[model samples]
Target: MSHPVKLYVYDLSNGIAKQMSLQLTGRQIDGIWHTSIVVYGREIFYGQGLTETVPGRSHHGSPVQIVDLGTTDIDQDTFNEYLAEIKEHYTAEKYHLLDFNCNSFTNDCAGFLTGGSIPEYIKDLPTDFLSTPFGAALRPTIDAMFRRPTPGTTPAQVPTPTPVSTQPMPNPELVGSILQAVAAQAQRTGQPAASTPQATTSLTSPLHPCANSASFKSLLKTHRAVVACFSNVVTCPPCRVIAPIFEDLAHKKGLKSGGGAGAVFTKIDLATPSGQALGSEWGVRVMPTFMFFLDGHKIAEMKGADANELRTQIDLLLYQAYPPHKHTSLSLPAMQSLSLKPILFSQVPNLDAVANKLLSSITSVNNSERVKQIITGSVVPYLKSRSSTKALPTVLVAWTEVTSTLSSSLPPESLFPLVDMWRLALLDPAVATWCAANFSSSPLVTLSRVASKLSIQQCPRPYALTLLRLLSNAFSSNVLAPRFFIGNFRLEVIALVIPSLLHGDGSVRNSGASLAFNMAAFLQTGRAEAVRNSNGGGTVKSDMEDEEWEIEMVSAVVEAIDREKTSEDVVHRLVASIGCLLRLSPFYDTQVSSLLEVLQAKQILKAKLQPGQCGEKGVEKKEVRKLLEEVANKLCA
Candidate 1:
């Protein structure tokens, strides 16, 4: 389990006849070739793009020979995903060569895949030949005429970079050393990393009732991620109805059960002078208003005596967080002290124009056609394209102004466009991150704020699905890995994600499964590293220690992963997520024993496998069965 990488080497042609190319014009140069990193075999061969990477009766006449490179502390699945990205990159013409072709790709891959490369002879052949003056003069000519394109494509001019070495040399230990989390992240995401410095912000803790509006305002200004549960025993009869639910939820135990301890909940009595002042500032006309605040922004409000409505808003706010306080309550220095990479905004153009229109219109007419058009047409497009540039304070300001005034800015009849704009904005990580950090406290910036009106029972399915997808995109920092577990972010998002996973929409379930995959995969990779560094060290034993949350998470994902109904992508990702959880609670790890028993992880997976599920080829059920079998072996071992 500690070191888990395997390499696949292919001799592309039969006999040495394939390597035919002598000192000059067409001499005996027989050789065998073609290679791919076989890191996670049956465990992950089911994903797309395997036709070329998987060794079989390939375009090359002969079958491939497999080699064991052993494993590294890295998660083999993630490492495989990283390798997939590499194979995708190398399939390009710029990196290929006649002497160094597929073997060269394998060499680079082996280095990245494990701490070893193929025996040096395969890589050295090209370098040694190109070094001699006689061979050097003919090398370019030979490659130009003989080097072929990948079966279907036209061959491109291979750039004259340094050719691969043909002289045999020992593979250096340092070859694969540079490959760690950063390289894997770079390849997995397919984009350059952010240049911003590490940023840290204080996380809000669960709160008790506020004594007065002054205390409420003071606490509110200090941190983002707060919820004010308003009530009064004397005056408001309806406030009394939802008061106990609000009080219990404001406590640690209630927040713990809900998976939103990073959020603060306060009881504000509207009867008090300070409560009246606070209510006036937020325009509170009702008695029991559950106001959700993020980054000092009021995102959603449920003003009613209905406990269910109040709980619904609280759930949404909690679901949007990362590492709920129950998980963080133990105070592990490794997790709590980790420095967070700043979620900087990609500065957009025309900030003033967008802000001016929304502000002026909201103050006067409440909602204007001109404001919606500019936001939908201009504001969102700019964010999509330039979201990675740098943090734009002015743009953040505009977002704050627009979101804070959202309720008063638009009437119910014309609210759809603004919600549409919000969903689009959520897709951009920079905008999403920036919004979460700077504009979250303002009610207007949260996706749920715009999406609050769209009920699946009342609206079209796509509307609800779109909102869920927006939530998924907002948590898409799984690409970077850092943003997924830094503080309370994932905890908040998971609260929202679990319900969507249970949603009836296949597409909604797919997005939810993907989000689950990201969360579990992130946790698994960290735990994998922990396994390597210790004598099987981890303290996640007992149901209360980690079981309640981990079980709920895995159970939700397993329930959503229906081989018969789910899409191929959904099945694959969900299976991978389950695989992640299985790895965390491997049969050998006593620490994760509680999670193993309580979730019945193995039993559920076995029950889901049907007769034809693993037999079909095009449908991913076959691969799903294979992956499930592999997981079963690990869990039951």
Candidate 2:
């Protein structure tokens, strides 16, 4: 049955915004709007993460306006499933007052349920506010207000809307204990854990506030590069002048390097007693003094407030901290332009045929009958109707049971159809998330096991191809991908993929190339983020693991490129994988560079770039040749 969906709009300013906006911004905004979706006897909004409350009983009190958003035929079970899938994207740490706030979440939910959008006026509040001169001036203030708390700030100080849940929430401390136990067990056994996903703090705001001496010390200890500005904002005019410039530089550099791992910008006001003591300890008497710190020691300082000088020094610090890879200087536009998106095999096969094949492969009468029912009763219907509605949690639970039974009993060669079916279902983010979170029984574990059982040289073509595609599709889940990179899982993946790269079967090689590309893309993205956050340079083992994985993949890819005499498509994918592995890589100067030299990777690639040597002559071949040349240049230069 269809249910009514309404938008609950509240004025955060309590009707005062309309009265004062004209005077404050010289442009009248009707309200400082906060919105929520009211459906299924609950009011849902994004604040301190996704929250639900009894209608009209939220902390916002009663909404000023309720807009009829039309009705949705989506059932409560389906909607709840949808909520679980979307919750990860809407964490409290990810909320931004001017960007992704309450209105944005409502609009997303509205579209999902009703295939419509919230009113433009309500959605456009941030844009409208920022366009105004006064509103533009308030951007930094809005950012700082919503930013995650820096060190030394109590959790109570961070603004969070208290959620009134329909049911009692789980004990947070108990949940933490469970997660710690799981992680510990996983570490002891060298297995990947199904630990609860933690919300990562968003680093949207580059400037981290140093509240006192303790916070300042903590910041220096944690961050590799920090730019500390010591000044009294209330008393120092020059401090005010250079403040914006410093902030702007932080944002720019933070963006370039990726936040968190990059340089951290902080300000200490000498007007406060704590700030006064900090300044004394740093021996700063000037009205505005800029100190550059690397490895927790002050390396450079400037007494005057010079914008150009500040920019220059900050650039130098970043350069010294994160030296550009030699490949970055090469003219390799084709390699540079390679898209880092995961290469996915998403084509849907005949579901009935696949189900029949799976049923025929099962030997146990009871298990066979149960699997058949799941295919017809839950899995098939869910896959068909997933576009318009969500499957109940039980649908996935049933599939999980069926997967465990078959994956354990079925022979390695007989598992292709089952793996193929799982691959199709995993395209749904909901299923992917469930699989990612349920580590032990995850079909991904089954896929990995099946790959391990099959000899890389003698595996059936269909089974090998399906396994490769299944691994590729696993990257669909943001949650699963990261987990896959941890513990022994990463090594298992390397073991499966390296041999497949040089498989005698051309189709298996193609599938293997696609999987390799996906793996490389994942690493490249993480490396880029680390560089942006200034986390790439340290002796962190996670960084080392990533470097090791890349070096192994690159070695296999270069050999694959040399052996590949046909299929421009495979060549393109293989070269693209090499590019991603090398680009923005921290170990390019040492491990990766030395490996490339030993392999004579540049010469092998240049030989492939020669006309008629790599693949059949066509537009695709020309593209492959171009990529090969670029990769060759990046390798040698």
Query: TM-score winner among the candidates?
Result: 2
lDDT of 2 by residue, 249-327 (tens): 7766652222224577887767765567779989997979999988798889998789999988887776776565454
- Measured over all alpha carbons after superposition, the RMSD of each candidate to the real structure, in angstroms, is 33.2, 19.0
Cα lDDT listed for each candidate: 0.47, 0.69
Q: Residues 46-74, candidate 1, lDDT per residue (tens digit)?
A: 11123333334333333445667666666
Predicted structure 1: lDDT: 0.47
How many Å off is the CA of 632 in candidate 1? 2.9
Stretch of 10 with least lDDT, candidate 2? 161-170
lDDT, candidate 2, residue 422?
A: 78
**Per-prediction backbone clash count:** 52, 9
